[model samples]
Target: MDIEYSFNKRPTTDQIIELYDNAGLPRPTNDKERMEQMFENSNLIITAWDNELLVGVSRSITDWVWACYLSDLAVRGDYKKMGIGRKLISLTKEKVGNQSMVLLLSVPTAIEYYPKVGFKKQESSFIIEREQ
Candidate 1:
């Protein structure tokens, strides 16, 4: 498959919702407004496409000098195990350069996947639960 990758090319909310569903990544697809805001406020977005299909994405917020929070990383279920996820991460880090470290809060299913992509496991992070 010839997969194309793009940076900061925002897909429509409908496309995003479809992709999240197909990828099995749970998100607030029921609330289009919130979904739009999520992508709007993010500074970095990298997406993979198979022709017209949205197959994978990596969304992040970064300062380019200190820290980069990779908020979302998803690959369509049928497209998994094909290195698209790794490439998205590679591209994200490439854009951020070496001055900043990339961080993400992994869903339980992805805890093992991160280490293979060059992320060191950290137990020092903390988060207050989101009420929603």
Candidate 2:
């Protein structure tokens, strides 16, 4: 697949929602406005595209010099295991450089996948759950 990766290239809300839904990744895809805001508020967005089709995305909010919270990583179901997600993260790290570290909260299904991509399990992390 001739996939092209780009930084800060925001995919349309519909494309993002479709990808998220197709990948079975949990996100507020039902609310288009919130989805739009999610992308709009993100400072770093890495997207993988096959021609015009949005195949994968890695969205994050980062300080560029301190830490990066990678809030989402999604790829079309058909495109999974093809290294699209890995490339998106690799590109994100390259852009942020070594001064900052990438961090994320993995979904249950993806819990075993993160460590394979160089993320060490951090036992000291804590979170205040978001009310649904």
Candidate 3:
């Protein structure tokens, strides 16, 4: 199993949709506006490839000077724990650099994972879900 990492490279809309599908995240319809908004306008996207297969994706929306909100991070289930996810996180962290604060909202499962990458538990935050 030879795996390679490519960072800061933009993946196509179809690639994103497929990766999201494999990760069990939301899949997009044929709407161009939603398609255009993939990755949250993240100029910084990290992807991992196992040969031609997309194994991982990490997206962040950052100002490059202050704070960065890591919107989504996923790895195909078969590819999990192979360092692909860590590499994606590393690449995204490097892109954000030191000037920006990295932020994310995690489900219970991620609480252990995030702290391994230098994220601390934060209180005093609230969320209002969008109408879907």
Candidate whose lDDT is highest? 1
Error of 2 at 107 (Å): 0.2
Per-residue lDDT value at 104 in model 2 = 95
Residue 111 of model 1, lDDT score:
91
lDDT of each: 0.93, 0.92, 0.76
Better of 1 and 3 by lDDT: 1
Candidate 3 clash pair list: none
The 10-residue segment of model 2 with minimum total lDDT is 1-10
lDDT for predicted candidate 3 compared with the true structure: 0.76
Candidate 3 weakest lDDT stretch, 10 residues: 24-33
Cand. 1 Cα-lDDT = 0.93
42-63 per-residue lDDT for model 2 (tens digits): 9999999999999999999999
